[model samples]
Target: MAGHYVIAGKKIPNHILSMGFIGAYAGAYALYALKPKPAQPATPPIQASSSDEEAFIKEFLAKAEAEESK
Candidate 1:
């Protein structure tokens, strides 16, 4: 006698159960392969500053010295 599946006390044929399993796997794989990817974020453009770097450093140091003296 060949082996069979007993689901919910009902006898299911092996070939039918195998086909159902294969069909489910195929359908899941199809859905996974056809799914759309998320969109990539756009990066902002860099701008060149027109301000003087030396003046900025000097101003920062002056503020730090003033705060330390208090």
Candidate 2:
């Protein structure tokens, strides 16, 4: 009664409890290892056109001029 576990007025054997714990541990690891990984989308490398670069440079210069006039 001191070290034994009683469930519903019945005593559970030590071997059964140890097996249940081992089974649960194995099951948890199995699920973790077998879980599906998320698919990552492949991204294309960005190539900036000359027109896009010119537009960006113009915008950046406009912002700098506005900040300087403030």
lDDT, residue 39, model 1: 80
TM-score of decoy 2? 0.52
**Which tens-of-lDDT digit does each residue in 1-70 have in candidate 2?**
3356898999988778888999999999999999999977664434457878868877777799899999
Clashes of 1: 0
Taking all chains together, each candidate's TM-score versus the true structure is: 0.51, 0.52
lDDT of 1 by residue, 1-70 (tens): 5678999999988988999999999999999999998987664433336457656766777799899999
Q: Evaluated with TM-score, which candidate comes out highest?
A: 2
Q: Top lDDT: which candidate number?
A: 2
Worst 10 residues of 2 by lDDT: 39-48
